[model samples]
Target chain A: MTALINLVYLISVSLFIVGLQRLSSPKTASSGNLIAGLGMGLGVLIALFAPMESGDDNYLIIIGALVLGSGIGLVVAVKVLMTKMPEMVSLFNGLGGACALLISIAELLNFHDSGTFGLAPYLTTLLALLIGSIAFTGSLVAYGKLSGNIKDSWKLPMANMINIILLLTLIAASIYQLQALDTMDLVYFIMILSLVYGITFVLNVGGADMPVIISILNALTGVSAALAGIIYDNMIMLMGGILVGSSGAILTILMCQAMNRSLLNVLAGGFGGGVSSAVQVGDQTVKEVNIMDASIILRYSTNVVFVPGYGMAVAQAQKICKELEDMLEELEVNVRYAIHPVAGRMPGHMNVLLAEADVDYSKLLDLEDANKFLNDTDLTIVVGANDVVNPSALDDPGSPIYGMPILEILKGKHVIVLKRGMSSGYSGIENPLFFHEKTSMLFGDAKKSLNSLLDELKTIV
Target chain B: MHLIIEILTDHLTILFALIMAIFLGFELISKVPTVLHTPLMSGSNAISGVVIIGAIILVRSSGSEDYISLFLGILAILLGTINVVGGHAVTNRMLQMFRKK
Candidate 1:
């Protein structure tokens, strides 16, 4: 490598590190991403400039691929809705996995003709191939689930067991190939099994129960890329892969902590998917509140808190929620948003939704801070949210989500819940908080309900 | 045999570096607040596209590549490029929403 190329690589690595550091804070996150992107662009530019064994036609092909890829990326980033961001992320991640998988395949073919292969690169090739195929196929499955193309319940019985068997088969094939003299059959078999295993593995995970990080199969892509980098001795891939691998792991641990679930349970295709063992029967009636009464309560309150959940996402009520917050703030009311760690389908889903509506980040409070303010608040608005604020999570020992930390919206002096009906949450756990005397149900779609409340507030104040 | 030994040491070096990177990665993004979580996830997803480096190395090293290998190399390059460009662009778009005004 030329000195100039080496210096650029070093600069790119620095940019990645610095950008990642900035991403830890919302204030600098935009600039951080730009910096990292600049680094990646520099790397791509150098790759084009560097000499390759291919003829002039190959250069045309490379540039063509880059342009085609960038066009697709640009369209996806610029045009896709924020609500579908997770699905887009998973699809792109799948492509990255495909990159690694193809690299390993290319290298494996190279080895077949060379008649010589080192142990280290050989092992790296196998590892990359295994993990890469899994990441690609698994990410596609995840994208399907997120996009509702595949039903959540579409899973073979004992699919997890089948996955383990396939995994063992892959390992045994690789081991057998090592003992046997040069043969490409085992490697090809391993690749097929890995791709098949990926599908079967994620198939069993019901969408609602899928863990935030592991569900999308992000870390696996990074793992495969890092291994592939080792095989080829590529520093850019090495650094980027390890960074993603660790970052994804960290997020997984954090999401698990927030959900109060064991990492093992998450990896075992998630728990509490179909039926709940802790169903409760209650005869208490739920009080219904109209927009007029709800707005009156809100207008009079000194402090109000908002607890949003998946229902908000489903109804697309984030914009109205922001409007309501602004209206309340204008009425000299102290308004804040209380966010449960697992409030939405994924980690930080609600935050992203609200941010899209240009809600101030500072007004967003995590579960701990929200708990402190809820007790003193005069009214707490629960919008399209259920389990996250369900006192059942805190008090009902027999509830499936009993031990999970919730928003504690029940602690407020008065609570208004906007819901389509008195249905159970994603975990199939019924909430007793709906029937509490302090809580009043606002039965409707979240967006319409919030619009009504916003209109009523304007009229009253 | 000497060349093989050198290669083994290089792999070992990469292995050690990977181990340390994992720890450092954990430490850096440990306490990221809920609001920044999606952006961070998107950022890391873009970083995963670094496999393009491996793709380039494979494509460049092959002296007399056949049609299948070349096709696969092009496919890898395409996918890697998509990942880097789309991932980072989407992340920046999302982050632009949250950067405090």
Candidate 2:
């Protein structure tokens, strides 16, 4: 019977791997999600057959929890706005972390009850509890930050010092617990401290670093889950957890590379928080263009590219952006969108927003392709984007965002910036791109500006 | 000492499984396009919901009189189910928008 169950688990693990592989592309992604969900269902079903104490009400409790959880999850999944996806993903990640934390606590209590004193069991249990607690609270804080409930700049004074001390204390606590397993209080103490550490660890990180932080928390949750599997000797959980853990780690590295920042730099916090050093533009004067002239340029341009940022998401202007793209296409203009990897709050955020607006994924060009296209493009419209297109990232070494890659919007024949004001970007770095000779600012709320621009284009054609 | 060694020996296969899974995990999504990063994130997040299995097992193995264990186990199941259900559903919703038009 055990061997048969293991066989089923093996098949489920295979499906998870295949599902993840399929998810690497857009065409198979949705079905791949379903396939992974199917694997989860099989794993859950088989777990029911595992040997257990004969409690008649256990099945009832399990069924009730599953139903309630599924109903809430389904409702939120269907109704959440695409603009709020980062927050939604953060919330879901928190719940997974919380689940792992609770599992560790429950398992630890069981071990205490049984008076089990093995080295491996206690070690795994402590690791799970520590990591699980951290992932749970760290994720919640991240969700709060993303949702605007918590300030992006909020952090404890001496945060790095505090974090190091907490980490050291946790290690000392773990060693003590290992040596003296007589009481459960030490376990509870470690849990509480770990939770506090999670909050401080994430609180120090700036808003722009959310993609890396979210990915790290996701990987932490996976590690905790694997630790839980280790405690219970569950092969399926171990397989699934390790897969998510490693993949999430890779994703975190990818996000860091996109910003040209090391993981250590991000975790040290305050990258995009304070005002950066003043880098004087050649001239303080920026050329401003009216809607009519901008429209005229768009009308006659043979090729144009749209660059979007978090501001686009903020103004809820993606649909308008898409509409403008379609109109340009009808006028025989070759329109494409240049998507910076870290453009929005999370990874691929701009892509998701544009996709939600019904823009074909094929119309979106990544960093390299977009830069290449920009060189030949007659006009480039930057919609509510700042830092990602800032030329300072290229030439200004003293700039906060110097090493980061940006869309070479200035390479185009003409540039129209749709912005609300002359304020610096999230990293608080001044953009010389605004003052460049070829650049023109069309100032207004992004959605309103785009609406007027569209109206102007309509009159021209 | 004997018990400790026994536990380590017993975990040898599980350790092997873990090491192999980690290597495979790194190799699996190494070359994903930037466009699919978000969905890839949420999808793997759903897979981590496999902890729901352990939660179920925890609940089953707990005696009826063990109220704390039962409560914690059931809560784990609830949260795990939400992660699995919500993560996958959201990822699918996002992926559905990526048409080739």
Q: How high is the lDDT of residue A147 in model 1?
A: 79
Off by over 4 Å in 2: A53-57, A272-278, A281-283, B1-8
Model 2 agreement with the true structure over A76-138: per-residue lDDT tens digits: 999998889998888888888888889888878878888955778878878988988898899
Task: Please write out the lDDT profile of model 1 over residues A15-47, one tens digit for every residue.
Answer: 887888888887778888888888777776776
| DockQ value for model 2 | 0.72
Q: What is chain B's TM-score across the candidates, in the order shown?
A: 0.84, 0.89
Report the interface RMSD that candidate 1 achieves against the true structure, in angstroms: 2.5
True contacts kept of 2: 0.81
The TM-score leader among the candidates is: 2
What would the TM-scores of all predictions be?
0.94, 0.96
Task: Give me the candidate number with maximum lDDT.
Answer: 2
Clashes of 2: 0
Model 1 DockQ vs. reference = 0.61
**Docking class for candidate 2:** medium
